[model samples]
Target chain A: MCTYATVHADMDGSAKGPGSEWFHVTAATVYFDHPVHAMAEHTLNIDLADAAKGPNGRVALELRADSARALIKAIQDALDSVPEELRV
Target chain B: MSEQLTARTIQITGANGDEIQAYLATPDETDEPGPRGAVLVIHHMPGYDRASKEIVRRFAELGYDAICPNLYWREAPGAAPDDAAAVARAQGGVPDERLLGDAAGAIAYLRALPTSNGKVGVIGYCSGGRQSVLVACNLDVDAAVDCYGAFVTGTPPEGSLRTNLVDQLPNLRAPLLGMFGKDDKYPSPEHVAELDDILTANGKPHDFHSYDDAGHAFFSVDRPSYRVAAANDGWAKIAAFYGEHLATTASTPTGA
Candidate 1:
C-alpha cells in the first residue's frame, strides 16, 4: 500500500550530493513507503534536498524501520556527548 | 501470435494543456491486422519508472496499444524516476482533478489513433490501482482493472488526503476487474467485500479475485512482494477481461 504519509522539515546545512559535489541543503522530506531500491516491502525514506537545486540535488536514504529508529538514537547520543557550551 | 512490438517515449498533452512525457507501446502493424483497442496504464506512486513502462509494453504485447503518462513530469521534468517520485510525494501527490485530465488526454490520444477500434481500458497498480477505479467512475472507459489498490472502500491511514469512492461507485461506467492479495492489509478482505457489495447492489458488472498466498504489490516483479502464482493468474484474468470488453472487430485500414 502507498501510505501517502509524508513529513517535511526546513533546514540549513551542507551535504555531498549527485556528481560528488557539495550543495546547500535546505529541506528534508521523510516518509515510510515502498522503496525504489530497497529489498524490503517498505522502508523509512529520507531525502535531504535543496529544492532550489532541483530534484537531483540531494542525498537520499532508505532504511528499515528499526534501522531508522537506531539512527535516531545514535544521533541523539552523539549530540548529548557534546559539551553544553559547544553544542550550539 | 507475433511477439514483435514497438515502444518508445513520446509527448502527450496532459492536464491544463500541459505537454507531458509518456511511454507508448503497440503491436507491429503487420502482426495484428485490425483496429486495436487501447489501454491507459497508470503508474504507481513510484512515478513513471522502468517497471511501469514495462507494464505498458506488456499490454501492447498482448495486442492492445498502451500508454502511460508521466504523472510527475510537471514537478521534475527530465529528472530520474526516483527523484521525480520523491518530489511528487513531498508535494502531496497528484491532485485528483489533474490526474483525471491526464487520463482523459491519454484516452483521447488512443482513440484518435488511426487503428483505434474506439475502445479503451484502464489498469493501475498500487496507488494507481485506486486511480484506475477512479478513472472508470469518472470517464467513459470500456474496462477497468484495479490491482490491489487501497482506499477504494476503506479509510486511508491517518494524515492521508485520500478518501473512499463510495459516493462515486454509482457513477462507474465500465465493467471492473479487481485483483487482490488476500493478505493485503489496505484492501483487506473486509474492504474488498465492501466494494463487492456496493458494486453488486448498484447493478455494476465486476469480477474480483483474491489469491490466498499473495499480498500487496504481488504483481510487482521487481519487488520482494511479487508473488508469481498470483501475478500469473492475475495477468490471465486481465487478458480475458479485456478480451471480453475491448476486443476489436474485423481488420480495417488506418483512417478508414
Candidate 2:
C-alpha cells in the first residue's frame, strides 16, 4: 500500500483567490505508491486543514485499512531509499 | 480615538452544534455619511476580549468596518479563572477542528451582515495570524495578512505552542502578505525561506518581509516584543497592501 497527504492550495498559483473572493478546496487526492489488491477495500481519512504543514507536520502516520501500518512503513521506507548524492 | 462602527455580539451555531460568540463592528457611516469598505479581523487563539475589540476600533478609525470572531468556541469555558493561572491555562486547550469550524462560522456571519460593503478581507497576528490565513483559504476574502504566524515546514519542534496552523498552507488562496521578524523564535529565517521556496515553486502570489532587529510580533508597540522601527514599517506596508486589495472591490473607485 502507498499513501501520503497533499495540500489543495491555490489552483491559480496565487496564495489567495483573485476576483472570486474565498479560497477553498473542493476535493483532495492522496498519493500512495504501494501495491494493494485490486479488489481490496481501502479508505483514506485526511484532515484537509493540515496540508499546509508539509510532509511530517501535515499528515499523521495512520492506516485506513487492515494493513495500514504495513502500508505506512512501506511508503516511508521507499522515501528513505534516496541515495545521499541523489537525495537532492 | 476616531468614531467607530457600533459593534453587535451574536451567538451563532457552528459545525456540530457548537455555539460560537461572534463580534461584529461596522463603520457607523449611516450617521457620518458616505460608504467605506469593511474588514474581517480574525482574532488569535487568545479569544475575543477587550484587546481584540480595540483592534477593531483602530480599523474603524481607518474608515472601515471590522468584525472579529471568537474562534475558541469549543474550548472549555471559564477563561483565565484567576490571574495567577493565566500562563498555565493559556496552554490548556485548543482543538484544531474547533477553531477552524468557529472561524468558518464567523466568515458566514460577516457575509450575511447588512452593514458590510462585501469587499471583505482578513488579518491576524501570532496564532490569529495563521487563523487569518485559514479563513482566507476556506472562504472568499479580498486579502489576507499574516504577521509572524506559524508556517508549514518539514519538521515539528517539540515545544510547539500551536500545531494545526502549521499544517494548513496548501488550502491557502487569498493574496497573502506575510511579515516576520528575524528574531521570531517560532518562525526562524530558515522556516521563512522554506515557505518562500514552496510558495514560489507553486507560483503563488505572495510577498514576505523579515526584519533583523525585530523578532516575533513587533506589531504591538505596547508589548515587550515590539520594535518601533520594524513595527512601523510593517504596519505601513500592511496598510498599503490592504489599501491596494481589500479597500477596492468591483464597486469602489478603482475596483472597476
Note each model's CA RMSD in angstroms: 1.7, 17.4
> Can you list the residue pairs that collide in candidate 1?
none
Query: Which ten-residue region of model 1 chain B has the weakest summed lDDT?
Result: B247-256
**Model 1 lDDT, residue B95, Cα:** 83
Position B9, candidate 1: lDDT: 90
lDDT score, residue B188, model 2?
Answer: 74
List DockQ for all candidates.
0.81, 0.01
- lDDT string, candidate 2, B71-161, tens digits: 5543423332121111222234344466567666666666565545556678887666766776766777778888876644435334444
How many clashing pairs per prediction, in order?
0, 17
DockQ of candidate 1 compared with the true complex? 0.81
Name the best candidate (by TM-score). Answer: 1
